[model samples]
Target chain A: MNITSVPFLFLFLPICLLFYYLIPNKKSLVLQNVFLLLVSLFFYAWGEPIRIFYLCILIVVNWLLGCFVDGKKGTKLGKWIVFIAVLINVGSLFVFKYLDFTLENIGFILGQELPLLGFTLPLGLSFFCFQAISYVVDIYRGKVKSTKNLLNASLYLSIFFKMTQGPIVQYNQFESQLISRKTTWTGFCDGFWRFAIGLAKKMLIASNIGYVVTDIFATDTASLPVVSAWLGCFAYMIQIFFDFAGYSDMAIGLGKMFGFEIPENFNYPYISTSVTGYWQRWHITLGAWFRDYMFYPLTLGPAIRMRKFLAKKKVNKNVAKFIQNLFVTGCIWFTTGIWHGATWNYVVWGLINGAFIIWELYKKPLKNKKLDSALGWLYTIAVAFFTKAIVCTPDMGSAFSYFGSMFGLNGNSLVSDTTLFYFREYWIFIVIGTLACFPIYTKIKEKLVNNSNNSKKVKTILYGIETVALLIVFIISIAYSFKNGYTAFIYQKF
Target chain B: MQEKIKEILGELLIGVDLSSKTLADDGYIDSLIVVNLVSELDLEFDIEIPFDALVNENFNSVEAIEALVKSLQK
Candidate 1:
């Protein structure tokens, strides 16, 4: 079920919370964890009952494999264990997520239709699979110890809050907290406040703008107006950020309510002037996961080892380093792309983003803040606008045609009534959405905190206003949800 | 020994000049730099650092790196 739905918001969460708090303290705290595991399983089974079985099987197998890897840490068995675990996890993902796409491509090439066994994808299959692989790999690499208990492992792999669209919290981040953590009044208040903010973001902001973007994306692009194309593209760009980040906020807030601290995913990524900076800020957990597991290993693997060997033969260190980085980064982005979806367009989007980031990193490192504020920032957003079309479109051909319309190619109108109509409908929201991308409120709060001239009276007044504002946002979000229905997050489909 | 590794890392990673203080904080060691550092150190010392050895404690400073290398050599 959608987390924001009426059933989930009013009935399911209340019942779950009631059961959770009713559990008493006991030996090993296993009782509380078991209650959570059962509740989480029920949560997963709500949307996809059959697929929930697959998730449980994955948890059990990965937990066993993790222990095996840990047991044989210093031997060849450890390496083989990791290889097998990765293969099983990734192979399942391929079968479920990519088999249909792969078969379609093969049919196109061979001029014969293959029997397509189209399987229904499980909810959070990619996320839980990635978590499983990361857990095994982290154990293999000695990054974290294997959790001794299976129930704890199950909870880690299948927790409902983060299961849907993850900030992709790593193994170690929650391991200790799983053992023991507190649920204090302050933490509960903060968690509720955070959840309210995310609810506002999704209910009030993302859903409204999402309607316009969806309409725009659905329109035929052959005769679409240039201004309308640009407007839709920019709207989609903002819509996606808020939609996914909003989910992340609620997940983390839920984590806080349960005395687990989930990491922040977005750091006002739109403010970043560089593509590299953008990656660092956006979906931070995903980036770090790739950096540690994918990028580092690939870079330090035979590719760089061979580069190092060549450098020993009097090759230029700089040249060899640059070539290796290019290769490794290409692979990282390609993986990142496919991880998002099964389509070729996602892959191309990844390559495009990868190309821009590499160019920025090598040609200029975005160190000059003064120059960045002038025109460089606009260039970054422009690149994202074009790239976002590839990401949001159904196929490559439609995406390029949309780009053509955006650039006033293919006999598309430069301006039209449709464009004006959209502007009339969406201007206020567009302004609010655009401004929300920057941390204006956060900056002012930081200023008040750091500035020495601020007094106790000022602090108290500001805090009071903030509390009242939060309550208003919370009430409004709930009201909106009741008036309208739930809107599924864009990233959760990935 | 620490000075030697420091010199190599400073030469290898581009952008800001790195020193003991910067290394200790590890504030500047992005993924790009870490890969290059591992390769260069592996080449210079002719000893492989395992994946587990990529921990913050080992890579946090010149001193930590020197100690790790010394132990690996033994």
Candidate 2:
């Protein structure tokens, strides 16, 4: 059921689009939504036949909870209801995603062998659960009114475009679109162009470079040559960005084709001058989610309380602020890490990122533009390299060994045949991948539009060129997709 | 109230311009600064800025912040 598969591209999407647009009454929102809902359910069930039932029950439950929580704003009952809703959503996520990991650790601590309950995780459980929680919370906070229609609720949480991996659209942001939307020929063309670009990014770039990354990591980290280690890490850095961002582009493109606008996720994250800036651009929706839902709440609630208590005790003002910042940053990162997976490496990765971000906060390296831009970028990339290494490695031991090789700390050669071979094979993809990390195409498009000066002729020519380029990209991407069988998006696991 | 907010923002952000209309959107103030500003405003005005009022629009300018604080105080 990978979206890049031939069946999906040729059969499922074409059929779905045909039926959707073929509906006689384009103005009938209910009919369109009902059609979309059924299709979305079918998409889910097609992938996870048994887990579709779990998703349905959760959807109905959250819909009912949203109903109950609405109009009870500022009351204790409303607060409790929202809390229970969050509990149900997060509890389910915990049971499916984290229970086994938690139990194993507990067993280790208690010196008893505990039997593991092997429950298969449903696809997109993490994503939909977050959306469900946001729906109830937004209702309770009076940000968005609860939908009385179960269809709208189901569609909101289980929309096929965003269900699997997301830009994590907030309920308030998506509620309006669900009610009223317009599908135009122009919009569909634009969506198709975007989807074509995403497909190219994935098939032409990410998948091509990914083979080298996988092969390098499969080698013994301790014996990995320094050049090979660096090469693998560098390739991985590109692979992950294109893989996730490309998927996001496809999802966004699909949304546009259906008259929905999914939020932008990645915004040239690799060009960020600081770690803090990097987070702002990378996986933007997730960062915003953490900021709005977790960071702000913790800051306004416990961090503020702790600060006040420290102030009352006559603690130094700066010291109190520092401690508060540390607490907030620590909590956010710890959760952010574990949210990626039920692995200690992910936790470590999160904490490492958090530490670097906190350092930037205090240092304010770019505040006065004091640090040179080139140096700042280098520093940020260096941090990213180590963090990406941590993410790709299986465990701490492997990560350290990889790092050791990367720095020539391990008794490993500087250059190896593997490194030379990878460079020889993937140099073009590597070069393209690196350049594609920036907004080069966007800049070019902007330049064309700016220079066109409202001339219809120039506009027409630009459009023609864009269309042709997109067609070429699509054809090549289709070829690559066929050559490389179904490759799952990296973020799909998260 | 506007002057008070400007003063607090000035103290926290050092070289940032407080008169800009899109402080948050323009990246003049990040989340850390926003957290500190919220805490400061809460203590200064003795008003709890509800989470719903914590959107970017309310914090994107000194005037907007003043308005949010005034409403919360009421």
**Per-residue lDDT of candidate 1, residues A134-232 (tens digit):** 889878877678987999899999888999788797887778878888777788778877888888788878888887888878889778888888888
lDDT of 2 at A252: 94
Q: TM-score of each candidate?
A: 0.93, 0.95
lDDT of candidate 2 over A209-320, digit per residue (tens): 9999999999999999999999888999999999989999999999999999899999898898878889999999889888988898898899888878987899987788
Chain A TM-score for candidate 1 is 0.95
Is model 2 an incorrect, acceptable, medium or high docking prediction? medium
Q: Relative to the unseen true structure, what is the C-alpha lDDT of residue A240 in candidate 1, on a scale of 0 to 100? A: 86
Quantify all predictions' global Cα lDDT against the true fold. Answer: 0.81, 0.88
DockQ for the candidate 1 complex? 0.45
